[model samples]
Target: MSPTRSTRALRAVDAPQSTLSAAAGELIDADPLFVRERTAASELPDPAPLVSNLARSVVEVISGVRDIEQLSRWVTDDVYRHLLIRTQHAARARQARRRPTRRPNFVELSVRIQATTENIVDAVVVLDFGARVRAVTVRLEGLDRRWRASAIHVL
Candidate 1:
């Protein structure tokens, strides 16, 4: 058989019918029990303490004093990846400078949290690092019955 003939035969056997039944559409619309439902902001705990702690922990991770894995459970995958990259860069810089890994001397100046929706909150955490001040912005979303950081930015 020619190559084109065999390819066509295989495609015909492997391809599924494009028609979708009403039952399938209904199933798609129905909520599955296996998937966790997002919780409302009101149902979640106050985000101030968590935001402050997370900001501090993030700074520590970037300063080589804390592990990025410790913050994984509280942040989304994208945020975790971003933190991991920052941590690695920080570690390399510290290594290049031959600096000791020590806890950062920082104080939480203030935390401001605002609710944008029923399940979303935006927070800004201010920190005083003795000589410099920094702000960490975190977006918290209620997911799986808890508040998780979906986005974080340090400036």
Candidate 2:
């Protein structure tokens, strides 16, 4: 990110702690299951990539796809080569048989991020299949001033 954008995030993190007049935030904030850090809504970083990439990987796998390269690009290290081998094999087998293997359903998502000083982000995403949890992945990465994904995991 540009220096200006970096400054904006810094200012947000350093805001005075006394101001308390604001309307409700996103609709999800009202849910009993919602837990948030950085008391101010302004502090929440955009999680779309984390959410989207996560959903895409699960959906791609369960759909019996052989296009591991695409999903591999989003992963860190050998998750594509080592960790995901069984999944890829299964997908390829299902495809060869011309039968559907499974479908992806997002079970839950949780993230813990710290936005001041140096940024740290950790994410956990779960995908379900019918009554069973099909996959669970954990991701950890640091953002530069730009807050881009630097590393991702399938753990």
Candidate 3:
């Protein structure tokens, strides 16, 4: 039709506020030092792979086989600092024992995942280290359309 008709039709339509726009409002220089994005669970990928990979990488980091910096993008600042502290302790223990740094021989046995909320998942990754079994628990939160480890513990 006519331009006037189209303009009138558009004017008659009511538009609603977008969730994306609403979410973006929180990012407007509220805190210049720390800024993080929240993503909907449906917009994220499966957490299983990230959980498994992070578990393995964390073990390697503690064993001095991997650098903690490699995981910085996939974890929160608190988790990064915690992992760094653990890595330091492991390195010190190794130094005390005069053990040379080597990659740990391990196999991922299984992963158990539970969703605590739309944007959060708690998972346990079981690893077999030949002579022993260990479990790594990770809490993943959806951020910026991806998974970031908010908490991690090895036992």
Off by over 4 Å in 2: 1-45, 92-99, 105-119, 143-155
Per-candidate count of clashing residue pairs (backbone under 3 Å): 0, 0, 0
- Candidate 1 residues 1-155, lDDT tens each? 56798898787666665534454556656857535478999898888889999999999889987888899899998899988988888889989999989999988889999999999999999999999999999999999999999999999
List the global CA lDDT of all models. 0.89, 0.50, 0.90
Error of 1 at 95 (Å): 1.0
Model 2 TM-score is 0.43
Candidate 2: residue 141 Cα off by (Å): 1.6
Question: What is the per-residue lDDT of model 3 for residues 1-155, given as tens digits with 9 covering 90 to 100?
Answer: 55797786565454345644555566655766556687866789888989999999999999999999999999998999999999999999999999999999999999999999989999999999999999999999998778999999999
Which candidate has the top score in TM-score?
3
TM-scores of the candidates in the order shown:
0.77, 0.43, 0.78
What's the lDDT of the predicted structure labeled candidate 1?
0.89
TM-score of 3: 0.78
- Could you give candidate 2's per-residue lDDT for residues 67-137 as a string of tens digits? 55666545544445553665767667887888875544554444344333334454455544557654344
